[model samples]
Target: MTHRYLKNVVSLELDKDKCTGCGKCTEVCPHNVFIIENGLAEIIDRDRCMECGACANNCPFEAVTVEPGVGCAAAIIKGWLTGSEPSCDCSGGDSSSCC
Candidate 1:
């Protein structure tokens, strides 16, 4: 089954203008969040993204960018376990205080 996070919360972005249709994002994404269509990469399911930053790191043309471990998987899991609103603590504080 496909896993999806909170709607409209993921930070994944794709710059189609910079994409080279190299399919690197498609290959590196663990969640299958991207797909190549019409010779360009498209965000098929933004919520499916875990904000892992693998796609961005692998994109040779720097077409993708995502703030990894910010407010997606870790926050969702923490919310599920604590029965509270999802929070990533992205206050730009110490790294140990985040997520």
Candidate 2:
């Protein structure tokens, strides 16, 4: 699947030392951001991540760390201008509170 991306703002840190190569991340990622090879889960496409928190939530070994937020400059600017909280609509507005 081809996942669209605006920017790579999601803070994803993969600790290979903690990964068990379970491929669980691959299964839960909607954007195909993770790939398992040589008994390890590698971040093949960090930019494609939508910060949905699925990979981190599903990982049993807690190998994946994701901050789960958006990088929308327009939303941020709008929030500042409107004096409201910035939120990302991707995946769901509730996932990323970018104000």
Candidate 3:
């Protein structure tokens, strides 16, 4: 099955101008989030990203950026278990806190 988290919530950003078509993001991404096409890196599946920061770290041209460890995965799993909307409530002293 294709794993997808909250739609349009991932922080992944790609600067196509800086990509240079190196294909490093495609190689390092665990979720196949990137694809090199026409000499530019593209974010093929942003929701599949687990916020692991691998693509950003491996991009030699500094084309990719993402806020890793933003509790997206945890929030999605929590939502699945509770049948609620995915949310990352990092505030302390709360039952719904995913941090």
For 1-99, candidate 2 gives per-residue lDDT tens digits of 764666756688899999999999999998788988998999998888877788999999998998864457867776788787765543355674444
Assess candidate 3 and give its lDDT: 0.79
Tell me the TM-score of model 1.
0.68
Q: Give all candidates' CA lDDT scores.
A: 0.82, 0.81, 0.79
What ordering of candidates by TM-score runs from best to worst? 1, 3, 2
* Clashing pairs counted in every model: 0, 0, 0
Q: Give the runs in model 1 whose Cα sits over 4 Å from its true position.
A: 70-99
Candidate RMSDs in Å, in order, are 7.1, 5.7, 7.1
Candidate topping lDDT:
1
Reference-based lDDT, residue 47, model 2: 83
**lDDT of each residue in 11-79, candidate 1, tens digit only:** 889999999899999899988888899999999988888887899888899889998754466667767
TM-score of every model? 0.68, 0.66, 0.68
TM-score of 3: 0.68
Error of 2 at 85 (Å): 7.2
